[model samples]
Target: MQTSPKPKLLIFDVNGTLLNMDGIKTAINQAYQHPGAFTQWFSWLLQYSLVDTVTKTYHPFSEIAEAALQMTAASLKVNVDAVFMQDILKSMQQLPPHPDILTGLDLLKKAGYKMVTLTNSASAAQKKQLEFAQLNAYFEETFSVDAVELYKPHPKTYQYVLDELNFDPQETMLIAAHGWDVAGAARAGLQTAFIARDGQALYPLAKKPEFVCADLHELAVQLAAL
Candidate 1:
């Protein structure tokens, strides 16, 4: 069997991958007074983000986030005014990195891997979240789909990063917590690592990630072995 070459560029997915979303859950729970409101809001946010992408109509991720929250609230028969929605959206900026993120990033950095981020969040918002979490230093660069005006699971989103880095697809690996994001990178010919956070699973129809680890620290350890 031919061995796969070591990856040169490691692109990470932010949000639930590196940054924990518990803050979001808590905020939604408090504001909506509805059980599972966070899950529903997140689902709607993702759905609409892709809807915009597919329709070629772009809206800032924050805008979509608010809209999704409003929709989620309405579905649960909760009426949230604009001020309440803004407060929920603002919580996104204060999210902290997952417990294993710093250690995992240090392991990769010490191993001399080039790291960057590719997120669906707008560049400004992503930067603020990373900076707030103190994770900005670990990454060499950050890219956002806002640059391409598309969301993940779109082939072009992955292609944009590859083009910027000028690395062969086989020599780059995308690490993400979302199955759809991992599948998108894999479909774009990049190698993939799936960080399966709690309650997250890979899309069964897509190709499997080369590595599936429970947390970033574990994923880092596995990558270091390569």
Candidate 2:
């Protein structure tokens, strides 16, 4: 438990951290004609996100979603239309929060921690997801890497949020369920809290998070204690 001095701003990753997107995984598989198609698409989505980031090419997350789906479909030897792909993405916007998210975020807000979301999704899409989960009001701001034309694991993307909020890296903590995101923030010189959702392993290339918890409520309690 490496506790930093009290944090002035808390930046959170949207997907997997606060929101429960398991349903979206089901929806994607159902939309595609394969059992593991959703997983393949998601993996490729990450690959493409990194490619776009490293190449300095920008694409909306929605576009990445579509491309990944198409590539996955191709790999599976199936064909899908743009309209069907759009449906899959629209379904993503309807995902609900994890069971403990609302109560936890409310508690943190009351504790005077400034909460903001930093996501890879586009601003409109991110807003729709948060709004659907009823988690929007708890946040001071919602940010998307789309504005910076890059994605996470890129140091520049994490830096963009700090720059936009006028926050010092040391004063802001990036909380996320994804280990790569934790790594990226750490590289950018921000403290990190890892919410261990889905039992994903930590990144080998990056420093471990300052705090690791089972979920957002546990993290909220820890942050409040600080």
Candidate 3:
């Protein structure tokens, strides 16, 4: 059997993958006083992003997020104002990285891999997230779909990164907590690693990625073996 080569460019998915979402999750749940508010809001955010992408229309991720928040509140018959919703979302900009993230990135960096981020957030939000998490310096660059005005799991979103870095699909690997994101990269001909974060799973029907690890630290250890 032919051996698969090691990846050169390591693209990371932010949000639940690298940064823990508990901070904002707590805020949303508390604001609504609803047990499942965070889950519902997040699902709506993702669903509508795809909706916009499929329709070839675009909205900033924050706008979609707030819309989701409002819709969730409406569904529950709870009152919410735009100002409060925006304040709740401001927590997203300051989310902290997971404990394992720094350790994992250090191992990857020492192993001579180039790292970057690909996120659904707007460019400004992405920058603030990285800076607030103190992870900006670890990455060579970061990408936001805001440029293409298309969210992830879209083939073009992955293509944009490949084009920007001039790396062939096979030479790069996308690491994400979302099964759909991993599937998208696989479809785009890139290598992939599925980070099995809490409450996340791979799509059963999609092609399996080359690696599936329990956490970023575990993924780093596995990749270092290569």
- Candidate 1 Cα deviation (angstroms), residue 164: 0.9
What ranges in model 3 sit over 4 Å off?
1-3
After superposing candidate 1, which stretches have Cα over 4 Å from the reference? 1-3
The digit string of per-residue lDDT tens for model 3 on 58-92 reads 99999999899989999988887778898877989
lDDT digits (tens) for residues 1-226 of candidate 1: 1156888999999989988998779878778897689889998999999999889899998999988987887799887788878877777888989999999999999989999999989999998899899998888889999988999979899889889988888999999999989999999998999998987999999988888888989988877877
Error of 3 at 88 (Å): 1.9
In candidate 3, residue 132 scores what lDDT?
95
Per-model CA lDDT versus the true structure: 0.89, 0.85, 0.92
Find the 10 residues in a row with the least total lDDT in model 3: 1-10
The C-alpha TM-scores of every prediction are 0.96, 0.94, 0.97
Give the candidate order by descending TM-score: 3, 1, 2
Output the lDDT of residue 71, model 1. 86
Model 1 lDDT-worst window of ten: 1-10
Candidate No. with top lDDT: 3
Better model by lDDT, 2 or 3? 3
Clashing pairs in 3: none
